[model samples]
Target: MLRIKGTIGDWPVDLSVEMDDADWARLAQNLPTVAVAPSAQVAAQPAAAGPADKLWLAAQDLLRRSGSVEGPELMDELEALAGSTGAAKGLLVRLRHSPKVKIEVRDGVQVFNWVEE
Candidate 1:
């Protein structure tokens, strides 16, 4: 069972979904799984960082060094860092949702800023 409650624009939304065991089995089968390390093995090694983690770090570094930057300029810099407009957009979306960053509108333009921990 799943329940979702939120507001869409000015409208309130409430949703509910119920699934049987078979449905859950189908969902699980469609999902990807990661291999887990044994307790001792895990404690002995640090987790590996993937490409997305590297890109995210670079994006954060860019914003931190700039202090604050307008959306368009930030997008331009992200595009260069990501090497593609599509990937840059993805990074921008991730940053927008990140706890370490904040977005504000000033002079009718959106600005992205790094939130120091």
Candidate 2:
């Protein structure tokens, strides 16, 4: 398995690819070769966390700690954490689509629950 984490422009990129030795060898066989002196190699830099990432962590923590919270109440907390209504709503939408979160309507109110894996 190969994991790649980086940013493109302003967007974050995180991906993983699984390849066996034979698959890797096949890929290498199709690629062009270039020779470079050892001194030409450059060290890789780690990707930096952005503000949206910070807010995401906080939002996940909020739901996890609460066990369950009403959607409106969660939005209020997210708004404070993100410092803007749009940003908070964006986070809410992200949570709605996340595999670890579950949303249900109870008494006509939407509730978000963090599912433990």
Candidate 3:
């Protein structure tokens, strides 16, 4: 697996793409086109909790898909989710504390393999 750590516009973004080195560079070159659009009109109340909700749901989905999602990979995915959603770090910590969990140890490193059915 290849990982790249860097900042995005001083936001201190750490991005990890699934692609190998060559592809990662290609993807990076293609990234400048994306933009964040501001809301058209200011809302009286907070827009919504969609991002936070998505973050938690994604965490659960990653755990539930251990048949295809490896433990280490799940952690990576969760971190990315948290970054994109601005979800509290506590979400990941809480997710890890779920009693119904499955894991494996490799060279003293713990990895999640699946979630309890």
Candidate 4:
């Protein structure tokens, strides 16, 4: 016997199913088999760029689009984009020292500007 109870949208749902041994046996017999290759048998592959690489690219794009943006605001956007505050802060620090980005002060706020070559 299988029972499922849940809510879909604003409506409640209840479902129950009962199967005998023969039904279970038939179902199992019709199921497909999956074959998996052993790790030793698989070919070696080149390493791929990780999430940090992707975040760096995204940070570059965001700066390019905005020309200049406040440091804290940029950090917030990067945090949302990276889904991690630590990652965002790390990227911001990297950007601050990057030759392609220029850090300046406007009024009392630090601003990041994309340096175009």
Candidate 4's TM-score reads: 0.57
lDDT of 2: 0.67
Greater TM-score among 2 and 3 belongs to: 2
Candidate 4 wrongly placed segments (more than 4 Å): 1-47
Model 2 agreement with the true structure over 7-113: per-residue lDDT tens digits: 99999999987767575445434332222111211112123633344446566777888989999999998887666787677667667766789999999999999
Please list the C-alpha lDDT of all candidates, in the order they appear: 0.69, 0.67, 0.47, 0.66
Give all candidate RMSDs, comma-separated.
10.9, 16.6, 14.3, 20.2
What's the best-to-worst order under lDDT?
1, 2, 4, 3
lDDT digits (tens) for residues 1-117 of candidate 4: 545689999999998777665654454343332222213212232236333444455667778889999999999987776666766765676677567898889999999999988
How does candidate 3 score on lDDT? 0.47
Candidate 1 regions off by >4 Å? 1-47
Which should have the higher TM-score, number 1 or number 3? 1
TM-score of each: 0.60, 0.59, 0.41, 0.57
| TM-score of candidate 3 relative to the true fold | 0.41
The all-Cα superposition gives candidate 3 an RMSD in Å to the true structure of: 14.3
What would the per-residue lDDT of candidate 3 be over residues 6-104, giving only the tens digit for each residue?
Answer: 778877766654545465334333321212222322222255734433344445655665553444566676656555322323444445455555556
Using TM-score as the measure, the top candidate is: 1
The alpha-carbon lDDT assigned to residue 23 of candidate 3 equals 53
lDDT score for candidate 1 against the true structure: 0.69
